[model samples]
Target: MSMTEAQTTTRKQALGSPLDRADGRLKIQGLATYAIEKSLENMAYAVVVQSTIPHGRIRSMNIERARQSPGILAVYNHHSGLIIHPAKTFGQGGAAAQAFLPLQDDKVLWNGQHIALVVAETLEQATEAAALIETEYEQQAAIVHPDNPDARPETVDALTIEWGDAVPALAQAEVQIGGVYTTPREYNSPIEPHGCIAHWQDGSLTLWEPSQWVGGARQVVSEWMAIDREKVRVISPYVGGGFGCKGGIQPHSALACVAARELKRPVKLALTRPQTFTAFGGRPRTHQQLALGASRDGTLQSIVHDSWNETALNDVHKEPCNAVTPLMYASPNFLSHHKLIHLNTVNPSWMRAPGENPSAFALEVAMDELAWALKMDPLALRLKNYAEQDPQAKIPWSSRQLREAYQQGADAFGWSKRPLEPRSLREGRQLIGWGMASGTYPVRRTPGEAQIVLYADGRLEVQSSGVDIGTGTYTILAQTAADVLLVAPESITVLLGDTLLPRAPVAGGSQLANLLTGAVHKTALALRDMLITLAVSTEKSPLWQQSPAALALADGFLWLSDKPNLRVSFSELLRLSGNDKLIAHQDTFATTASEDDRNKADSTSSMMVPPTEGGVSAHSWSAIFVEVAVDEDFGTVRVKRMVGAFDSGRIYNPKLTESQWIGGMVMGIGQALLEEGAIDDRDGRITNANLADYLVAVNADIPELTTIDVGKPDYLATVLGGKAVGELGIVGVAAAISNAVWHATGKRIRDLPITQDKLL
Candidate 1:
């Protein structure tokens, strides 16, 4: 059932209205439970010792000295008790990013690999013991950088897309522009570091961890321990933050479980800030050579994006650098290539907006260069080449308002008052400029389940294994149930982050609000059906002779569809039917991308039921405008203002979605002016891992941030007419900021974190 068609009562607000988060009070009052905060009897703490050498084999390790230290319980190196079988979660949509299991062998793939696990009576003792343990390695000459002499190109097939020939077409075009754009490695670095608590009870292993994929962890852990799937339980009731670091299982989680079982006590482990940068994984640095050939009129003719990213020797994960390259603009000929260069670096994992983030950084800035070459306004150039449909997929959009976003965002940003020449706008020793960029992200909807129960006391309960990751999942799910059952949002209780609840998809990809809410919708439909059947069979129910099809439920009451006054409370209906409550469960599974065209049910565009719409590509679009003030003397760039407009199908909560976009835009400012993960070239160690050295945009750094929502609903995308919204806002943000810097200084720096040194 579409939320657009949902029946409501006096509290009719839902789906689009702003509702306070249901868990807000619990969090503020410190009553909310986190994995690391959980207490159990005889609990121990563990700290991991990381490998210092980039590439080498452990000659030997001596843990005796550390084991005899104060409060020390046990210490395990490759030579000790830490033993486990290899994991099996691989292939399509697997959970594990780094295949090198912790403490499985003496081989060191990179610096910061887990070399040992030290357990003690307390966290302080464990930390001290971990530092005291001795390790020696037979270090080998290693290639630490992807551009090293020994680096070899490994083609990634999934990222390579071919259409018409791009090289020759570029040679014949009227206006051509291209350059090599580089972005440095960056960390996820959530406010609360990744941690987990593992325990074993009656042969069943349970884990309380901050993980996005609870089900995936259970599946992987079960295989690693050779235990039955039902014997492994992963619960994560609350997570502080998860950009992409928490999307999959980390090596520490597995190690914690192994140590807990061997010691027969609960073990807790948490990564330090520095450990998170190295052991947990970060965004890989990328270099792309791009070329854009356009007509004198600024119509794109040929486009090419060829790129390489840093990958480790043992693990192979591609960034899909060309994910946003092929279809954004109306290019007739385009070529996209992704190549991997193996280095002695730790395996990199997904950060937020993994593929599209870096892709848009290069693509959008290159578009600005092409516009300059054609002597055209940047926004005008983009308007001249707006794609009416998917250039590569040849499919119409499910719902798109990108044009409105561009126009509205431009109007709000005062694009009409801007001058084309660089260094033209000046204010008291500060040079000012304005720029814009377009953004896009595929709407990725995964399958999930929800369990709903209607009580005899006229209250409702909903349960799921889904996590929030600070995106307000608890609030939206409550609103969905309230709308479906026509009950006050406060009267419904929502339970999540427990494996015991109905299984749900990971909270990444910004799909939780769509998929989990759909699960709740489906469960509600089943429950309504059961209640209607019971009401008709009760004989004393209002209009007992009425058809089930003609009976409509509203505001916790049953009545004939046409007779608003003829009604019986749900509690009364339950009493007559001799049941205390009603329970319903549903699992939502998405069909193939093309399945929507063959059968409408294949769209499954919602969380509750099969889709009734068909034949379109579902995507969210965004546009951003940035104004920067660059100090002429010091070359310091400060963003003065920003305006963004988004078309993400339907708005679930305006305040939440607006905050999401603004947060992304702020991160974009950091990407353009302040953030980079610097790796030391001498020994392949990560430098500046601490927050003091790494710069993120603070509240003082931002001025005016305006947002506009294109509120048109999309029935074809989902029942709520909503597409994925979380990652869309950051897609083209860095590019827009950098473009503004170019307009201010007439100096275009293709590399990221456009620093003072580059600006001067």
Candidate 2:
């Protein structure tokens, strides 16, 4: 529990400098252990048996062949020894992507539903035994698509928004545009497909899973298993990637524990790449209809966004497709409807930038169409509709710099030199065009706890169960601690990815950094205050004569505020006090601003109001500019380059922030040019489940990327002045690329994956 005395330093890392990950050496040396790579004394492997039929009852069960297979210990069906509890939503503070439990009955709700599990001594045996299991089903007609005559889609009241009538206002506008845009279902496609290792002993269960929220996982796994919360332990030390797919505990995670407990052995379940498509979750396919009405001067008069998304047979999770419509633009009369259509498909769930990614393709393209009707520049149209305050929240914005982002982006991308008409600009044997779109994702914050310990030797340790899904959690926290403690990065050690550590919010929704920093900020300040108190508490020390109120911390010393040279180092003071280490723990609640800042400055968004009035709306904004080249004869579109100017509150580490932006652009390129999850209507199976059949972008597809930040810190979002950049770069990327393709070829493809056929 104590660091060595030789392991401390008093130098600090530069705030804007990039820091390499602390685990880089461990990973490169093959010493890092993933969930599937952990070895135990005796471990069993499990493979799930999926339902062949979309909807119906299992008429006859046939598990004799699988039960008799070599090394097969058990083949469990609904009537087997396995007992499971139905899914329940965690509380507001708890993290869960969805609440649909599996394997509770013999009725098949959808194809690829996990109906049975085969546990064996080896992975080969488990896989072979799973393939041998077969069942007879009473086939029933399935609802494959929402367009079916009998299909009924229900509008979600909570998701739908209405204000002044949008119907009449649309009819009265001088310029109007109506169009339908469709985005295909997509997979999470993290390199590390979901894998779990479950062990149970003495009525307690332990799971090593790559979950985004270990605390939430413990809560759910405990509840579903009828056990105490403390009895369940979850560990996710280093996640390969989440992208919202592994944000919570999936049903397979529980199944592994169930099988492990039943067989009295550790169970390991690893999903194959094919199973990754339908085993857990994927982004729902969307059909978005937009009607944009604008004045002759290109100001929005009205806007309505109607969406119908695919859902599973009984799953009621709603994709917030209309979420962006309420916050993005200025429209007096707005109507947004989100309807869920029942389909015989796997349960659809969140992907990166879930609603905003696909929704932007529809709304931004409609805005472009309105711009053409009004004969206005696209960027000019966006500036005309800039919202000073949140449209739906009706609250003052904490911080907004979208206008500056647009101006900076346009200047960098050479917007003034581009031809206004599509197909008017050309290169040798190719047509060149430029286009742009605005992007935004809300700045979300959550409550968290951090534990800090400062030793007599001057070393520090910070602990939290924060999962690092390759978003630089380790490096950023080290930088934060170094900056706060006035110590070198080597002196600060961050311990996370364990359930026993302090609980942290899930690492999705772009919230972890903002929320984690708040906790760290509060905890470090508490440690500093405690040190000041300890240094002046008694008359035995030099600082005992000085008041604690007049002390300032610099280089691990508490000195008089007015006299820089009069100081006593913490090490010497602690040595004299006969204490080895100082400990402090703090839980922070996210507020609009720091107490000092709130008490001092007046808050303003659209109107000036008292700073402490209420919480504020926070959003990270970007203006994406893209250039594309279309082969005139072949009808192929290629992105030549991309430039994005973002106005996220503060840049914690500019290098990591730029890396995240480039990765998001690559993901957007995949969405615009290639990436689609195909389904077979005949049997409801995911077609092209494997990578060989389903394509993603490779190194050859990546284009030159340029990411620049406005570089202004806004304290309103958080006292640290940092906004989330995780999902900010992913939104609006597809729309920007698609808009550029239209500008190059003079053909607008509303459907996603603007493929070669769509180009022609």
Candidate 3:
């Protein structure tokens, strides 16, 4: 049925008590077995030997002395196994990984490259032995910045969206603004580090990993080992958090698998917190030039964004740093181009809103500048240029509430009280300012599969391979199933984090709920149909030959449309069916893309769910207003208060949804004023590799925050009618904070983290 038809169906009041997450008790009690907590018989510990020099060649490896050290079982390097092959160079763009295969080759292209791995009986012994191994290397000069004259240009990935002659339009425009904005490198520092436990049993490998994408990890592991994909089983029942860092398979997993095979025992490898900076992955630094031309009345005439980013020597990674600029406003002429420059740094990977986050920083900041130049209100200017249709794709949005978001956010934030001039408001040596930004993330959905089982004991079980990653997936899935099955959530068991289960999509792109929940709802509907068919076919049943469509399942009982009193309990029906359990599976595929769509040609946009109100094609929208107090003397910016309004579709649980927003705001605050990855240009080493030196948003840095969920039901997206809200909460936050900083200090800080040094 079309989404409109689905919406026409009366909204049913949620049945049963508010559904509690089935795994909440286990998680709170620390009974949940995360990858690092798993224990196997005869498990050994492995420690990685990493490269100290950022750019160099390993002349010789002297491991004899360390091999003979106490508690060392085996030391493996590139030449250990004939079957171990180096990682193949994949086609460029964003598909590249950060740290390439360990022990794959001898040359160290980037600092912290894994050169050797030591396996020992104890974690301490393995670590101590790893430190003992020595190596000699020939250092090479490296280029870590795009502005460097010696930097070589490479084509990592390129995306071109052209509409009109931007150069000529800019030449004819009445006003123009040009500036370069740079975003520093940063790491996604989840509470739990990337880790895994691998065991090789008769050539098949089993691994317990903390990952967001289980199937992706399985694919990478299989490819790394040259083993059949089915031979690799990856399980991640509970991940502390990934934040896009744990989406792909890293070197440590492969290292553990190889170590286990050589030692004939389960091997566990967890990167030290400092090691994670290099061992895992980080967001690449972006250098971009924005040229915008507009009319005297603030109408966009032309916009051209050219960006260059760095990738590793072995792989190419590109961030569409200008992705949001073209579509963010109504512009007649626009061009966005990206180039990759090879650096002696680890390959960068996706972080939250990898492309748009940095892009928004530049675009929104530039918009603020343009507003100031035009002596116009930033919100007014944005409203004037807002696109009713997506200018990039030339399609109407499934549903866009951006104008409503701005109006509500401004009303709630008391925007009328703010002074127009920057640095005009101050109290007690502090400059106070308020800033806001519009946030948008494209709706994304993909094919997903789920299985549901109904037991005779009045319990339901939902199975999918989707990992939760701490976003309340378990609770939402259970709630969706319970709402449909008319069963209590506590009585329903949700099973996930196994590849052998029904094929589910990866838990990235904020699309998990839109993708997987539809399959769950569809499966529940099918299960209800089966139960009705069974009751109707039974000779002893109340409505022996009733049509299935004339009956409805509610309150754990089946009743005819005309006779509510005549009903049979689900448990009773199950007993009559003479079966202990009944199972059904569902797979929901994406709608075919039209031939005229250019996004279809690109892999990133191929699987994107088309614009729909509810059937797995919903987008979440939010507006973040930030209040900043800047100390002009010390160049310190403190977030005093934050208020956000989100249209996340229907919130499954108000408490969890609110918490997600708060968490996202906290993370956004970090991205705005604290998080940065420091690199030593002399040797291309990550100087502040540990958490102590690399700053994050601490409790003291956080301020009073309020999250308001405008729980508008999206009728076009999914069975639940909820859009992907996880990433939207963070998408435009940095810009809001940065804009606030600009308002407070009267200084346009183009760089990220708005550091004190930059302010000074």
Candidate 4:
């Protein structure tokens, strides 16, 4: 699978148009309703009170003063009217939640832990009263260091993979590099904060939430409230952005529901931006060490990765930091393991690229060191060790054009003019350097259901429970329906983000486009089949008893496959059949690895099942090339230009895909040079909790960025022949920036958010 002469000339085509997003008008005009915008007729407000001390035990809480405040309704604490059960901590299901529960007991484990909920007639009153409620605590010693080398907590769910003896393999290697990489804790920071509106009437609950998975929310709320799962309805019409933060229901949602149940009125609760950092989840800080053993020719012999991450005292969250290390390159002897260390901090959940983002930074930077040691070109070294197949799955790739990605990206970057030595390609006072790294993300597929309704006026309505999250989901799904039904995209209307509709998978993991598009396509085909049967069986002036396969549909008309002129509008055919509309539903699930075997059956009955099928493991690949200039006098690193070449199978919507890729690159830039979660070791407090103190990439800091699609169609992955594109664009970006920094200055930075202090 090298970039041979014949392979370098092959070019893939784009599949769809770059038109306006289907919901663009609604979003731009401020007509789209987010979760916080939903207001019930008799809705009240609720605010949470958090603990002041980092690690402590609650002694007593005095709420009498708060109850006397203006517009105060009621304050619910540990001895409250409604009881919320506290679930197990640090287990499989519990691993997802950062905080255990709100005021389940009086034991405070971390600073900013929710202590009480205040409900009032107005939002202002709830906030004021919440501040007035004071609590006395017995403080204790706490640990907040992310780089505590000797820290190890009890293992909950740990994974270990060993192929051969790593020590002997490393000893025999000609070149070896060992270093530790650390990434700071960071928040997802979606534009809209986490919020939920809950109304309970006659033992049934209706919730308006901002969530990625409505089905999962419904289940969590049902079990937490001790009610029937069918008794709850979750509605999320639009979400600002999740980034894997809104996967399930959080404690604030339960607090809102509890307040509603106690007061017999609807309650609304939205976490403030400052509170969002503590209440909601963030990416935990990770400390990882990578030891690479390679031959003089740039071939990897063995690799060992050990990582330790921080989770909350009560809950455990572990990122698969070494997920790609074992199989990324052609390493025969490999070992990867991760452990969790509990700290008195908020629980960290999934952010963008969860496991792979930080892991790739470590692995790719180590590759750069290996290239330097062997005196080889970084791009050529990567190409030399390219894995022909997925070593982890022991299967061929569904469709991998990484070799082509490397060649095209290198040509676009002018790699031939790059100097081999660091600080050797200087221009004026700035030292210019070029570096490149390859990105990869697995293609995950799950079950999805969509229903299509053909109206009498030739309009089509597509229904699914998936969320848009400002990713142009509505437009892409509409295009898919249009392509299959042979109708104009404007004639199709998409209805989504409702639990009452047909079940769909979560919109995370870049799976929705591939999974939902296939379901919509199948449903449209089914509707077309039904329309053909109605047209042929009718006694009207048309072909009678014609086979479905022999009929062709185009421009809202049905015609015989052999005849070009003989056609009838669908409206006339349905009118003759004595029906004004037709409806069809199709439920499609990804074929798992077991589906390849005739005798095996699926293990789990859950709607979202993992793909275990024995086929080419599907994934999206990319090559990121960056140019940076180092100011040696001031220790400032400036990213001048960046270009990304991606192979995300089919390109359904070119405009939206390009936007997503560019946005991802911007985020990667932030991770490389600015973003960091600073913790105060004196009392284990997050020193910079607000947006002003903590830095993210602003418009002025961003460089000129370009995205190009290596556009290879992957028919083996799904019917649409598309892999997930959301996470892969940002995977290798940090490493590329770091490599570029090393080229500009002779300093090799292994830590993330490469600060100026490191350069000095």
- How would you encode candidate 3's per-residue C-alpha lDDT over 36-119 as one tens digit per residue? 899789989989888889776888888887788889999887667624544422232121143376776677888888888998
Q: What is the TM-score of each candidate against the true structure?
A: 0.94, 0.93, 0.92, 0.93
The positional error of residue 740 in candidate 4, measured at the CA in angstroms, is 0.6
**Clashes (N, CA, C under 3 Å) per candidate:** 4, 2, 11, 5
lDDT of 1 by residue, 1-760 (tens): 3222446342456556788777889999999998899999999999989998888899989888898999998998887756676664233335665677888889998888888999999999999988887888999888888768888989888778878888888889999999999989878778889889999888899999987768767866776777886898898888888888888788888889899898899999988888887786678888999999988888898998899888778787677789788767888898988999888887888888888888998999999998888779999998898988877777787877999999999999989998988889999899998889999877776666788888787778888888888888888887887767766677778888877888776677677788877788788778888888888888877757678898877667788877767878888887777789888987665544343321111112223221212567777899999999999999999999999999987888788888788878878888888889888776788888789887888889888999899847777777667887888888898999999999999999899999999988
Cα lDDT of all candidates, in order?
0.82, 0.79, 0.77, 0.79
Candidate 4 lDDT, 406-478, residue by residue in tens: 8888888888788889988787888887888878887877767789998777778999887887788888888
In model 3, which range of ten residues has the least summed lDDT? 596-605
> Which candidate comes out best when scored by TM-score?
1
Comparing 1 with 4 on TM-score, the higher-scoring candidate is: 1
| Candidate 4 deviant stretches above 4 angstroms | 1-15, 86-99, 146-150, 153-158, 540-550, 560-566, 590-612
Q: How many backbone clashes does candidate 1 have?
A: 4
Cα-based lDDT at residue 179, candidate 3: 94
lDDT of 4 at 501: 80
Candidate 1 at 3: error in angstroms? 20
